[model samples]
Target: MAKGKKKKSQPKGKTITLKMAQNSMELTVDGKRRLNLSFQEIAAVPKCLQKLCEVDELDMSRNLIRKIPDFIDQFVGIRVLDLHSNYLEELPVTIGRLQNLLVLNLCNNRLTSLPNELGLLTKLQTLHLGLNQLDTLPASIGLLKELRHIGLSDNRFTRVPGCISRLNNLQKVNLDRNPMLTEDTASQESVMISESLYVVTESFLCEHCRKKLKNKKLEISNINKVQFIAAIVANMFLGVKW
Candidate 1:
C-alpha cells in the first residue's frame, strides 16, 4: 500500500475588493468610501494585483499614489488605465511592458517628462498628456503608428514638434496654449497627405502664386510685385528716361 500523499497548504493573505465603475473596476481601501489611499497604511502591495493584471481595465484616479507600484509592470494584458488626478511626477520605464495597452490617461499630473520607451506602445490609440509641466516630448513618440489622437494642451510646449506629422494614422492633434506656435505656423504645418506626405509651412506658401509650394520643387515662371517693380524702374532709368 502506498503512503498517503501530502497535501499543500493554501497561502494566507488579505483580500482586496474592487468595485465596478464605468466599464472598469475601482480598488478601494475599505468601507470608508475613499478613492485616495494616502492616509491608509500601504506597507506592501496586495498579491491579488498579480491576478487582476489580467483585467482589461482599471480606474484608480484621484489616488494619492506618489509612486506607481513596482509590480504594475506585470499587468501585461491591461488595456486602459485611468491615472488622472494623481501626484505622479514620472512614469516607470517599465510601463512599456504593457504590450496590450491602448489608452492611457495621464492628465492632471505633475509629470515633467516622458520616457522614450513610450514609443514601444505601438497599439496605443489615444494618449493624454494635458495639464502637465512637460517641456519636451521624445522624438521616439513619432513611432506610434496606431495613434489616432494626441493631447498636448495646457503644457509648456513652445513649439509643436515637427515629428508629430509622421504618425500616418493620426487624425487629430491638439496643440492649444502653446503660445509660440503662431496661427500662421500651425496652419502651414497641418498635415495634408496626398501621393506623398506633405509638410506645408508658411515658407512653402508662395505669395506670387497664392498656392502652396514645396522646397526643392521650384516654379520658374512666376515673378513677385517687388521684382516686377524693380525691373520697370531699371528699364525706365537706363533704357529710356521716363
Candidate 2:
C-alpha cells in the first residue's frame, strides 16, 4: 500500500517568528522586502520593529494606533509607509527623519494639524491626507520639489494655500467635499484650470462653465497640434537645405 506523503514541516527562524508573532499582524514577503507589520489591531508600535532597518515598506493600515513613536525614525531605509485608517491625531516630529520615504499615506485619520518638519522629506512623491480635520498647511510644503500628487479632499479648507502652485511638478490635487470653498473658486472653469493640472471639487459645473472648460481644452489641443506640425515642417526644411 502506498504511504501517505509526509506533511511539509513549517518554516522556522526569524521568518517564522515574524509570521507568527501576533494574530492581528499579517506578515508577507514581496520579493526581497520584509513585511514588518500590517492590518493589526495594535494600538502602539512594537519595539521589535526598530530592528527592521532593512525594511523598505511598512503597512500598518486599518489598525487602532493612536500615536506614532519616535522610534519610527529608526526605519532609515523605509521608502513607502502606509498608516491609513488609524486613530492618529498628531504626528511625531521625527517623521521628517524618513528622508528616503517616497510615498506616505495618512488618509482617514483624525489629524487636525501638520508639523512643519514634514517638509524635510525632500524625496517624497505622493502624500495622502484626505478625510482629516486640517485647516491649514505649513508653508514649508513648498520645499517638496519632487511631489507629484497630493490628496486633501474632505478637509476644512476655505482656500488652498498659494504655496501649492509653487510645486512645479504637481500633476493632480483633490479638493472635493470641502464645504468652505466658494462657488466661484471651486467652479470647474475657474482660473485653476490648466492643460497639465487637474483639480477635483465637489460642486456641480454650470452650463456656462462646462462650455468654457470644453473650449479651453479644445484650444489647448489645437495649440499642441500646431506645435507638432511646426516641428515636422522645420525638420523637412532642414533636410532640404542640407
Per-candidate TM equals 0.61, 0.67
lDDT score of model 1? 0.67
User: In candidate 2, what are the lDDT values of residues 1-242, reduced to their tens digit?
Assistant: 99999999632212223434433333455554645455656777666666555677788788778889999998888888999998899999999999999999999999999999999999999999998998789998999999988998877766777778778777778776664544777464333221222353313467888888889999999999999888889989788432
In terms of TM-score, how similar is model 2 to the real structure?
Answer: 0.67
lDDT of 1 by residue, 126-170 (tens): 998878888699988999999888887777766667768788887
Off by over 4 Å in 2: 1-32, 183-242
- Where does candidate 1 clash, by residue pair? 188-200
Model 2 scores worst on lDDT over the 10 consecutive residues at: 189-198
Q: Ten-residue segment with the worst summed lDDT in candidate 1? A: 31-40
